[model samples]
Target: MRKALPVLLLSTALLAGCAVGPDYRAPALDLPEQWPEHVLLSAEARADWQQWWRQFEDPHLDALVARAVDDNLELRLQLARIQEARARLGLARAEQLPSVSAQAEAARERTPGAASPLGQSSTDNLFSLAGVLDYELDLWGRLAREREASEALLEQSLFAHDAVRLNVIADVVATYFDLRSAQRQLRITEATAASREETFRLEQLRFDVGESDELALRQAQSELESTLAQLPSQRERVRVLEGALGLLVGMTPAELMAELDYGDTDLEAIALPDGVPAVLPSELLARRPDIRSAEAGLIAANAGIGVAEASRLPRFNLGGLLGSAAGDAGDLFTSAAGTWGLSATVMGPLFDFGRSASRIETAEALAEQAEVQYRATVAQAFNEVRNALVTYEASGERVEAIRRQVTAFERTLELAEVRYREGFVGFIELLDAQRALLAAELALSEAMRDRLTATATLFKALGGGWQVEG
Candidate 1:
């Protein structure tokens, strides 16, 4: 036994030396060094992006984001998945260690008088106390590969949670902006309706005095009704957006409706950061959580190939039992009653209709699929960043253009009103000017909303914050 122990130790040391299967190497990406039209933002601006919602400088928005992070159901579900993965990792690690078990036994037997040569009955009792140790030698590194794959899966789950968090923050900010835009449009439409009503009344008075024709009065009434028609639809849209934002913060729609519908908060007061820092395309790929998750999945799959390969080779195990047994319970611990034994097992596949080879093939195919998926994830991340940048840049220009148009239309409305009152122009001309001004105002509001949303989307594409905890 002593000689066998030394040989066993030597074999264990040698078997522990190398794990079978391909080691993970991060795949190379063909990427550009810099983003197109990348803006060099100030360090202060870049820092603000770490918690991008804080850049808006709205206390309410900050509160909402905090609530969403804490209470959101989908995020909680991901956290639970991470816990499950962590538990699986623990199980995998445990497989590498030996298992020990305690055992106890008692037996009572009687010899019949007929079977006894002396014509006497005899009774005997037995007791035992023992322990068994069972351990796999891990000769082919199957356990090691399984542990490695489990670790990679845990990391993948963590990255997936982070990706979901990033999307949630972005969605909340964008949805809030949409709600504000809708509210502003609703206000603008209501005011236009009031102004049109006064214009209609004035035209009716003028017509009663024979100073205006029926056509003019009818045109004024039509404009007022059209402005009024927009209010209910706009208000309904605002309510729907509120319900959505409420759900994101883990509140029921009915519970959140009152708080959102009755607020007098001005959307214009929501201040956003200017000139987001430009990141290199290569750097962007490394920071994105979805891409990182995909890479981890590939690593897990690669380890899976090793595990499958190892399964085809011989398996080694060592088992032993140490115990004491005696007819009298008190003698169970005595040296005279002591017993011990050891065994070694070597197991390998003889033939299984190519099952082992088929497993290797399956593992290889999965690894290949994971690699392609990782590449596809990287490509998708790049495309999203490019599209966001383009939209942000274009949306800014659109806002500027709409601003100028608003100014021009406002001035034209004023001139038309004066000309109509002075009898220098017909009411049709004034009505046309009013419609143009209203459209421009609404367009300007929409453009501003788009600009803010585009910036949020870009921040999301850039992976927002990197301080995610696992």
Candidate 2:
């Protein structure tokens, strides 16, 4: 027995090294060296990108983002999923170690010996207490592969949680910008309405004094009413945006119904970033949570192939039981009642029609799918970054152009007002100028909002401060 023990141990050790299936490696990507735009790239800026919203220097915005990260429902859901993945990883790791359990029992049995020559009956009691141990030898590394897959899945969950967090923060910032824009537009509309009201009042006085015709008075009234008509819709838009922002910050229904406290922030007052990074390194894409999550999924799938392959081979298990059995409960621990056992089991698929082979093929196909998905995710990430950069640049240009237009239109309105008062131009001309100025002002406000939101999006596309651990 002693001679056989070493041979069995050596054989088990050798077989344990023969793990089946393919190993995993990260796929290579083709990436650009730098962004298309010409701007300064500062390492300090990159380091602080996680708090990019704070660049606006708005304390309200910073607080909103912090609250959303803490309480957003979607982010909380991702955290729950992470917990589940961690538990699954624990289960997988446990599979590699021995399982120990304790059992205790007491039973009574009665025997009838009526068929015996003596014709007697008897009653007996049996008691047992045992400790059982079961362990599976990883002859083909099946358990190890399963554990690897679980670990990868846990990593995927972690990255997914970060992805959700980044998205929530971006959403909060963009929605806040929208709300502020709407409020600004509402203010502008109110101011325009007041100006037209005064014009109508003066025209009414002129008509009553027989200095202006009814046509002129009616035109003035029409303009005033038209401007007033916009007030309700503009106010509604402001309210709707408030509700939306409230929800993004994880407000309850009651809180959404109430007025949101923005602490006197104006869209125009929000600061604009000077320029985006000129040279975004391709390797920085690795910091993107979605990309990392996709690669983790690929790794899990790759490990799954090994698990399937190992399933086609035999599984070896060793079991042992150390127990005490006694006819009397009081004597259960006596040496005379001691009992022990050892067992070795080999379980393999003798014939399963092609089930095991089919599993392997399925696993391989999934691995291929994961690889394709990983590549696709990486491609999409780069595309977003490129598009965000372009949009951000274009939005800035639009703001500049609109600002110029607003300035020119403001001057034109002033000149038309003077010309109309001096009786050198018709009221129609003045009315046209007023309308043009209002349109330009509103457009400028919208353009500003777009630019700010675009910056937030660019930050999001750049993965918003997520960094890989060493």
Candidate 3:
């Protein structure tokens, strides 16, 4: 009967308990089957998910992105959050197990009166040792709910870290492309300035010889001055872009310049895939990172309701104490001195009036807010993907037009130089042709830069190559 009493108490404790909080189930929402607009997400457009940055085929770019992922400040913060959540999970799980404690105590006293109740003349000494353990049975699943919330938070932190990494890669690639474009434009500006100077000199000579009017000379001078003004501005752009890139890759501009040379690299046109995998709206629920985080939070909030509901029910804690009390230290382990006791306790909040009720309401409201936020995030993601596709396609079209314009300008410059050599056209005419050619060449450089940026933007809008590891 002694053995059965503990078991019977446990059975009665579980039987009397009931969970008060609402159970968590994902809220349903109406979502589209897939993106309505066409995006050029072909099978070929999908690079190796493990190393998406390598698709650009720039070794330096790959290295920069790799370094940023490992060293970025924002990513490090998310990692710390993951560690915190793991610790919290450990704390929640520990609540389900016994809490044990040990104790050693000693006391001495003297009584000096034999005639009075408090005046005994005897000396007494005592020494005692004991251990205790306490645990709460999770009959209502309150502990389980708390543990689930912590685990969900841990997953959310991991996804948030991945999102930070993708943004870092995008920033590095965008900055590198900007630097290249600025350098190319600077080269064009210098060529134009030289052509303008030569034209001004020729016009001055013609005016002195009385072969050209002052108005004609002035027109030539005006063109030269305008082109010259552009050189300083273009040079400033190069300096600014260099500085911006320095901050991104964690280097000074002088250091970066030492490693990079003015070499032209071609930006190939990106071809979009014919048919992208049809991801339905329901799939979007699980695919997007921010949405996943929101959903995790919603789950956590729902678990919070359980936590509040469990508060209304009586809380049960079971504990046991074991050890020995003896007159001498060496007798502490003897069966004669050994002692132990067990207890079961329960307490309930008779009335917080409505605090528990308010908590449950607050949790439900937060969960609703998370659901709405998730849907909004999904809609915005679709818009971003479609917008990037349109921009990329337009950039592709611009590259073709710029290519033809550059070709025509090149031919025009060649003919104008020949005419000046034959003494049929003034040196100013040749200079005009050269200046126009430089502008066209720079325009082509800009168009190619735009094409690469557009493709990178599109890749980013597609959630930056999610690994689905979760």
- TM-scores of all models? 0.94, 0.95, 0.84
Residue range 1-470, candidate 2, lDDT tens digits: 76886788689978897778998987877888776754545665555445778888888899999989888889889999999999999999999999999999999987789854678888889999999999999999999999999999999999999999989999999989988898898899899999999999999999999988998899999999999999999999988877877887788988887777877799888988775444365755577899999999999999999999999999988899999999998998898999999877889999999999999999999999999999999988988988888888899899999999999999999999999999999999999999999999999999999999998888888888633233
Q: Residues 1-470, candidate 3: write the lDDT tens digits.
A: 68986786779667545554666677766665666566444344444544555667776667777767776677778889989988998998897677899988998877678755866577767788999888887667688778777878777787777666777778877777777777777777777778677877987998899988897688778887887888788888877776666566555456666654323543332232233333444655666676677777777777777876776677778789898998788788899998999887887888888987897788778767866776677678777777877877788799899999889988998898789657798757776787778778888878878877876776666666634332
Go through the candidates in order and give the clash count of each. Answer: 0, 0, 5
Candidate 3 lDDT (Cα, 0 to 1):
0.73
Predicted structure 2, TM vs. truth: 0.95
Model 2, position 157: C-alpha lDDT score: 99
Off by over 4 Å in 2: 110-122, 277-279, 466-470
Which residue ranges in model 1 land beyond 4 Å of their true spot? 42-45, 109-123, 253-263, 466-470
Superposed by TM-score, candidate 1 places the C-alpha of residue 177 at a distance from the truth, in angstroms, of 0.5
- Model 3 bad stretches (over 4 Å): 1-4, 7-20, 36-49, 109-123, 251-284, 409-440, 466-470
- Judging by TM-score against the true structure, name the best candidate: 2
What ordering of candidates by TM-score runs from best to worst? 2, 1, 3
lDDT of each: 0.88, 0.88, 0.73
